[model samples]
Every structure is written in C-alpha cells, then in structure tokens.
Target: MKIQAKSLVDTVAERLEEAIIGGELAPGERVFEQVLAADYGISRGPLREAIRRLEGRRLLERTANKGVRVVDLSPERLEELLQVRESLEGMAARLAAGQIGDDEVGELRKLLETHQETSLEKGYYQQSGDFDFHFRIVQASGNGFLISLLTEDLYDLLRLYRYKSSTMVGRAEQALAEHHAIVDALAAHDPDAAEAAMRTHISNARTHARMALERAEAEAASTAEG
Candidate 1:
C-alpha cells in the first residue's frame, strides 16, 4: 500500500472503532469484510486492514477457528477497566491541576455548563457532550502520550457505558455535580483535591456500570426462567 493508502486504513480504523464504541456494532457481532467494504465504499484490502487494527486495539478478537468479532466485555472485564480508569483519571486530574492554568480551567467550566444544559434537552446529546467534558480534562493534563492513548479511544469504549450510566435515574444530574466538584478543584490549583474529585467521579461511574451490568444479567435470567 502507498503512504496514502495506509492513511485510508487508519481512517477506517477510527470510524469502525467509533462505530463499535457507539454500539453500532454490538458485542459479539461478526465482522464481514464484504459488508464493511460495501458500507464504507472501500475495497476488501482496506477493510481487512481496519479489522487488523481493531484487533490490535483489543476492540475486536479473532477466534482461532472463527473470524473476527467485536469483543464482548464481560462484567469482570468491566470491573477491571473501571479500576484502571479511576487511577488514570486521578493522575490526569492531578497533573492537569498544576500544568493547566485558569484559561483552560475556564474552558472546562464552560464545557460543564453546556453539558448540563444539553443534557436536559435529550439523553443522546447529553451522552455525547459528557464525553467531551471528561476528555478535555484528560487532555488538559498535558501528557501527550496519555492523551494520545486514552483520549478518544478509551472514551469511545466508555461511551456506551456512559450513555447507560447517564440515563440511569438521577445520574445525569449527579454526574453534572461531580463535574462541578472537579472543576472547582482544578480552578483552585489543588492537585490533591483534583485527584480526589476525579477518583470519586470514576468510582461513581464504576458503581453505575456494575449496577447496570447486574440489572442486565438479572433481566436475561428472568427471561430465561419465563
């Protein structure tokens, strides 16, 4: 593939990744190269490249005997991911507190304001904006490596969970309040406070995820029993 051709693969990877994260391709869905090629108006070659990239990213898995499919994140994996997210986000908030100044802090505050406003309008729009609010905090840490690795990708994975979480009874308002606390800590330039706020925010999100998973499992069990 030429340099330009390689870039097309990269673009495919991103779009497909977003689609998976956004739940367009639900967990365990098989990837068909032909369908994807038709949808994206690309050739099989580029679609294959995209699949390979997703597999590398751990977003898709290829069974030894079967073809590639979207990863079905078990509850255990969700718990593990939540633990890691808490620690990483805490560090990000701490670093961002000192590394970023008032201007950037102000930007975050504005984002939160918009998030709250938009959230009241509709569930889906709120879900999308909430991601931007949290991601901007990660970017404000000024850690290029962490930002590059976690920014869109991690949040993409989290987007579905975030949507689910935010839609939970009273969680949308509660999450907005958590954002307020983190913003205050950042504005104060208090690293410890910022870290604590972020830790709490992620912890709450983890709890929400756990509850959601449990509810889903229970529903499935109830259906089976019926």
Candidate 2:
C-alpha cells in the first residue's frame, strides 16, 4: 500500500494537534522543527507541511524571527472565542432542539449519564467527554455550515481552553450540571430553552476562563517579583 504524502502530513499534523490540545506542547512553546522531525523519524519536509497545517488551524503561529510556536490562550482571546461559541452553539442548540431525533437525544442522555458517573468517580469531568457532548449537539443541528465552523475551524482551539478550564476549581462539577440543563432543554424539544441553556453554559465557562487566566497572570507576576 502506498501512503500518500498528503495523508502522511495530515497524520503528523493530527498528532501535533493532539499534543498541543492535550497540553503536552505548552502554549507559546517553540516548535523545533529539526528535533521534532528526528523524534518522529521523518524528514523535515513532512514536518514543515504538518506545521503549515497546524498554522492554518490557528494552533501555531510564526513570528518574524522567532519561528513557529504554539498559539497562546490569553484571557481576552478566550473571552472572544467563547463569545463566538455562545452565539454559534446557542443557535446550534436551538436548531438541534427542533431537528434532533429521539435516538440522538437518547445518545446525549447516555453521554451525560456516563459523564456524571465518571465525574463522580474521577472527581472531575474529562475534557474529551465534555467536547463530545457539545459536538453531538452541534452535529444534530443538521446545519453543514454550522458544523464546519464549530468542528472544522474552531474545535481544536476550543479543546485547548476547555482542557485548561476543566482544571479550574469547581468548574468540572458546575459544567456537568450545566450540561444536564442543556440536555434537558434538548430532550424537551424546546428551542428557546435550549438556546438559553447553551448561552448560559458558555457564558459561565467564559467567566471561569477569565478568572483562571487572571489568577495565572497574578501568580506569574508574583513569581517574577520574588
């Protein structure tokens, strides 16, 4: 079987994206192309191609002389992203409420139930599970453009922040409860309720992100001063 160059590049890009979103590659960390190429046992060509793909996804940025680095998530940027999410996902939920099937609702219910059990057992919600719940709702909305915007364009960046937000004290439990409310609205086929619930959930997440960022900055400042 012949492996296509594009496929290989995309595979490499996916691995790098997972590393970035999983926090293995810290935000603002430089990408040492040669080192990564050597580590992956691939040539620099595919590595560069992978970097270009990640850059297109906004997961990486190239500075004038500093080369490529992971995109940093700032509080202001996080707020902007979540504001867009609230608007987009709120609409998605509203549409989903009207269009989602009974089976889809059942799937969502099972997901929520699993999340509840896992959160209780692990003492926190898994970021991947949280994303799965929202992703399922967006998929149920039956809007191709909306799906592309949320899943294709913004999903990786969303995961990065969601991973960070999941670490903020009490956020996982609160988000679990919010997920239940959103699912309740969806199950009842209440578009207005679904939209409001989604908006509130994203809004709360944005607030938590802002507070977490502020605390991080303060700690950094104190450390620098000391």
Candidate 3:
C-alpha cells in the first residue's frame, strides 16, 4: 500500500512538472489543490506530496496564506539565473572541448547542421534542437557534478525561461550564430575558446531576456495609461 501511494505521488509530481515547464501552468499562477486533485482523480494526500516535491525542485513556492504558486520568472531573477548558467555552462564547454570523443564531436556537428537547415527553413531555431546541443555538450563534459547540476537541478526551469526568451525578435538567428561559434571552438579542441564562446552566448541571452522583459513592462504601462 505504501509503495503504491509513493508511485501515485511520483506520477502526480512528474505530470505537474511537465505542465509547469511546458507553460501550461504559467509562472506565478496559483495551484489549486482541490481542482488538481479532482482533475487527476487523486486524493489530496498524494497531490500535496507532489506539490511538496515540486517545491524541492524549485518549480513551486508556498507562502503562509497564499498557498503554492509556480516560480515567477521576473527580469531580476532571470539575470541571476543566466549569470549562474554562464559560469556553469562555460566550464562545461571548456571541459567538453578537452574530454569529448571524436564521435561526440561529429554528432555535435551534425546537430548544428540540422539546426542551420531548420532555421533557414522555419525562420527560427527549434527550441528542442538548441536544448539538445547544450545537453549533449554538458553530458560530454564527463563531469558528473556538472551533468547533474545542469540536467537534474536546472533543466526544467531552464526550459521554462528558454521558451519565454525564444520569443524575443531576431533572437533565434543570433543564437544560432553564437552556437556555431561555440561548435567551432569545440571542433578545434580549444578549451579557452570554447569557454569564451559559451560565456558570450549566455551573456547575450541574458541581455536579450532583459530587453524583452523591459519591453513587456513598458507595453503594460502604456496600456494602463491608455
């Protein structure tokens, strides 16, 4: 009975995490336990447990009287998160340049080729393709701690923010060019160049996100005054 209960809780948590990361559950949106419990046909016990797990994952937050809400992706928080990513992903790229096998390099090149083709055809970079490229590099870094930090701890939140940021005008093509530079450094097995490229890419992403947020806020203020 206990084992079954745990399984149900895990299921609920995974579903909720997907919903949040997929943008079905918008950031700062409150989660209603009763409605969710009823929708999933689960009791509040397991549902509450699932919410608690998401809290641990940093996907949800609970206040004294406000209940659980999805973590808000404000501009300030976005900058902080991107700064951390710049440092971590830069290190990952540097290590990967030294540690990646020839086959992995080939795979990365193929993926970039696909990205270029798709972007040219679709007029934007595919978000999944971008994620795949970053994920592959981090995995090839051969640093277990870095892998876990990126894949396990940060990926869900990263997906959420990436989805939001990808909407910025002209960002897709710019990001593709930056990705090409990173791939070039990796192909040459130059750790310093790889790290520099990764840092610059993430820094540019941060700036784009900030500018988008500022534009959104300005639009909102203009609407209010109008």
Candidate 4:
C-alpha cells in the first residue's frame, strides 16, 4: 500500500511535468491544487507531495497566498540561460568526444536511426523523443558534475523552450542535421569539432526559440485586440 502510494506520487509528478512541457500548463499559470488533484483522481496529500517535488525542481514557485505558479523566465533571462547552456553542452560534447567508447557511439547511431524513422512517421518531429539525443551524449561525457548540472538542474526548463522552438517551419529537419553533425564529431573523437558542432546546434536552437516566442506573443496580442 505504501509503495503504491509512492508510485502514485511519481506518476503524478511525471504527468504534471509533461503537461507543462506540452504547453497544456502555460508558463506563469496558477495551479489549482484541488482541481488538479481531482483531475488526477488522487487525494490532495499525494498531489501536494508531487507539487512540492516540482517546486524543488524550480519548475513551480509558491506565493504568500499559497498560490503556485510555473516559473516564467523573461526573454532576457531565457537568453542568459541559453548562453550558459551553449557553453555547458559544448563542453559535454568535447568531453564525450575525448572519452566515449565505440559501443556508446554505436548506441548513439542507433538512437539517431530510431529518431529518423520516428520523424518519417510524424512529419519529422516527435516531442516525446526529442530530448533523448542530447541526453545520451551528456551521459557519454563521463563528467559527473556536468551530468548533474545539465540533467538535474536545467534539463526540463531548457526542454520547455526547445519544445516551443521545435515546431517552427524547417526547424525539425535542420535540428536533425545538426544532431548528425554532432554525432559525427563524437564518432571521429574530434574534441574541437564536437564542441564547435554542439555549440552551433545550441546557438541555432536559441535563435529558433526566440522567433517562436515572438510569434506566440504577437498572436496573443492580436487575439487580445480582436
């Protein structure tokens, strides 16, 4: 019974994060604990625990009035985060190039093939599987601190922005090509090339994200005026 309840908390937390990433839960939206708990068909006790976990992840923040809101970093703040991401992920690629084993490189190749097939089926963008590519490389880096910082500290938040950017026209194919380049660099064990390729990929993603956000804001403004 205790284990089941714990499982329920984990399930709830996972779904909530998915909702946020999928844009079902808008950035800065207020969360209604009772309603959300009811929606999940769970008691408030478990739901509160789940929410607390997300809050700890820096995804949710609590207010003085017991209100919970998604963390909505402004454009400038998001840019700052992306800049840091650019550097860290580049470093990860460089390290991975230096140390990644043949088996792991082969596994990454398999992942890309899987991703390509997935893309063909879905017009080239699968939201659920998108984060897997970078994650595998970061793990291959073998740097515990970089792994912890990127995966634990910044993964989901960065995913949020990337999700927004990924839907842009032509971005899917472009990103896939970029992924291929990074993988090629890693396969060749060229640290300089790997770092350069990864940095370029991240930089391009930041540009796409900025454009997507601006379009969304403009659409919202138009709707408001109408």
Candidate 5:
C-alpha cells in the first residue's frame, strides 16, 4: 500500500465514512488495519490516521485487546441523537434565516430541485455530505460554534441514521415535502417560520424512524417464528 493522493489521509477518511454510511462496512464490523490497507490500496500509515479521525467522530470505537470496529448504535442512542439534532438544527435554521445571503437562498432552491429529481426518478431521499439540506443550512447560519457542533461533532452519526431511517414506507416523498417547507421558510427570511419548519421536519423524521425500527423488529420476529 502506497499513498499517491495529495491528501491521502482525508481521502481515506472520506471513503471509510462513505463505506460505513453505505453499509459496505456494517455496523459493529471489526476493522483490520492490514486487510483494510490492502483493500483500499493505501499504506497503514495514512489508513491509521483516517481510522483515528473516525474514532474522534465516534463512528468507530477501539477496545482494549478486542481491537477497533464500527460503532454500533443502539435504538436508545439513536433516539437521543435525534433529540440533540432537533434542537441544534432548529437553531441553525433560525440563525440562517437572519444570515443567509440571496445567493445561498437560490442555492438552497437549486439543491431542492436536484433532490426533487432524485426523489421522483430514482425514488430516494436527499443527498448526503455537502449537498445535504441540513449541511447547507448550517453553513448558511454562519455561526462557527453551531457549525462545529453539528458538522464536526455529530454529522456522520446524524447522516447514518438519516439514511437508514428514511427507508420507512412512503417516507421519501414526505421528507422531500418537509424539505420544501423548510426551504420556503428560509427563503422568506422568517426566523420563526424557519425554526418551526425545521423542528417539525426533525420531529417527523424521528417518528418515521421509530416506525421503521418497529417494523423491522416485527419482521424479524415473524421470521424467527417461522
């Protein structure tokens, strides 16, 4: 394994993040440095750095003697995470209403259009990472403290649950409609409306997530019975 990319560490971190989110690296799966380095075609040096970064993000956990594995979040923890997200992201939308530029508002509109296409044609929800509505709104908020808390501290965990939870029956279209409501409030520069819409959207997401989890549990139970 050799490093050719300029920022090999960052590249590897991002790829690993994607793999975890995409379920290529399943939750709680043990990670082996030697195998992963060979698989990713990067040296253990940079790959180790990437793993450490993810550890900081709480995406991976290291155990004494047991070694490192992807963080496997329990249902209770995921609910707690969503509670924090609802508070912080609601504040972000409120702040963004005051601070967002006209250009950024247009960017939000265009991003919605892209999401609309994907939702309609491809039959999925929003994009992850930079193209995400939540990501853009947090950027628009222009508050470094909130930005760091949401993006650096909790972004990956949030995204993982968001992607997983969104598969609830008929949730994709509803979530897109919620996004439109949120963007409308932001575009109007109404702090109250923006915060309300964002909070509502997050609350709805939490509900859908619970429903999805319950459905999965029921299906698993039925399979076991059979």
Candidate 6:
C-alpha cells in the first residue's frame, strides 16, 4: 500500500511535469493542490508529495507564503539557457560520432526517418518527434553524466519556443533538413562535420525562437495600445 502510494505520487508528478513542459501549465501560474488533487482523483497527501518532487526537479518554485508556480523564463534567461545547451549538446554530438556504433547510428537514422514521415504535420506531435530525435542523440553518447546534465525542464524551456516557431512558414521544413544533415554527418563518422552540423542546427533553432518571441511581444504591445 505504501509503495502504491509512492507510485501514484510519481505518476502525478510525471504528468504534471509534462503538462508544464508542453505549455498546458504556463509559467507563473499558481499550482493549487486542492484543484489538482481533485482533478487527478488523488488525495492531497500524494499530490503534495508530487509537488515536492517537481519542486526538487526545478520545474516548480515556491514563494514565501504564496505556494508554488511554474518556473518562468525571461527572454534573456531563455537565450542564455539555449547557449549553454548548445555547447553541451554539441560536445555530446562530437563524442557520439567518435564512439557510436553502426547499429546506434542506424537507429538514429531510423528516428529521423520516422520524423520525416510527419515533418509536414507541423503540429505538436511533429515537434515532439524532433525532440525525441535530439534526445536519442544525447542519450546515445553513452555518457550518463552528460545525460544527467540536461533534463526535461531545460528541454521544456526550448520546446515552448520551438512550438511557437513551428507555426511559422518554412521553419519546420528547415528544421527537418538540419536534422537530416546531422544524421548524415553522424553516419559518416565525421566528428568535425557532426559537431558543426549539430552546432548549426541549434544555432538556427535559437534564432527562430528568438525572432518568434520578439515578434509575438511586439504584436502584443501593438494590440494593447490599439
């Protein structure tokens, strides 16, 4: 019984974490224990436990007396985070290319193929596939330490911007082309090419996201005054 309770808490935490990442739970939104407990059909005990778990993950932050809110990302903060992520992920790509086996490379190619099938979808699921591709690359680097360094929260911050940029004309197709270049470099076992390809891919993604956020903010300001 105790174990099942713990499991429930974990389950709740996972779902809530995804919700936060996928933007269903926006940043700065207060988390109400009573509301979520009732919605998930769980008791407050497990829900509180779940909240604490997410808090530990850095997905949620607590205020002095104001309870918890989803962690917020300012434009500068998000850009800084992207820069750090690109450096880490670029190194991981280089290491992966140096040591990855043919089978692993083939598996990554397969992920790219799957993503290509829906590349034109230009929706949440398509973007989800893109995330999966990048995640598989990082995990395949065979570095547990590197894998631990990047977590879902960091990915979430990027994903929010990615999702918005996906709606832009030609962005999804451009992103897919970059993915193909990366996979090709990795398959050829060209560490230099692989690292360069991966770095360029992240650079382009950051550019698109920054532009999208800037445009959105500008439009919002215009609408507010008009």
Q: Taking the tens digit of each residue's C-alpha lDDT, what string does model 4 give over 42-156?
A: 8899889989999988888899986999877467867998999999999999999999998888888887788787764433443433348888888888999999998889877
Q: Where does candidate 3 stray beyond 4 Å?
A: 1-15, 38-46, 114-131, 219-226
| lDDT, each prediction | 0.77, 0.84, 0.82, 0.84, 0.85, 0.75
Q: Candidate 2, residues 147-174: lDDT per residue as tens digits?
A: 9999889987887777677768888889
| Model 1 local distance difference test score | 0.77
Off by over 4 Å in 1: 1-15, 38-42, 120-131, 144-149, 152-155, 221-226
lDDT of 1 by residue, 1-226 (tens): 1123458988888788777766588677898888888788778897798898878767888998779999875788888777877888899899999978888888887877777767744452333433477778888889987776666556555665665555466677778888899999999999999999999988888787678677767876899999
| TM-score of model 3 (CA atoms) | 0.80
TM-score for every candidate vs. truth?
Answer: 0.79, 0.86, 0.80, 0.91, 0.86, 0.82
Strongest candidate by lDDT: 5
Candidate 6, residues 1-226, lDDT tens digits: the string is 1223457877888778777766678767899988887778778998898899878767789999988998774578668978987898898898888888888878877876776776667542334433477777887677888876764546555565556556566777788888889888888888899889999988887887777667767886899999
Give the per-residue lDDT of model 5 (tens digit) for 174-220: 88898889888988999999999999999988888777667756876
| Candidate with best TM-score | 4
List, in order, the clash count of every candidate structure.
Answer: 0, 0, 0, 0, 0, 0
What is the TM-score of candidate 6?
Answer: 0.82
Query: Candidate 6: which stretches are off by over 4 Å?
Result: 1-6, 119-131, 151-169, 215-226
Give candidate 6's total backbone clashes: 0
Q: After superposition, how far is residue 114 of candidate 3 from its true place, in Å?
A: 4.1
Error of 3 at 57 (Å): 1.6
> Which consecutive 10 residues in model 4 have the weakest lDDT in total?
121-130
Q: How much does candidate 2 score in TM-score?
A: 0.86
Q: In model 4, what lDDT does residue 93 have?
A: 100
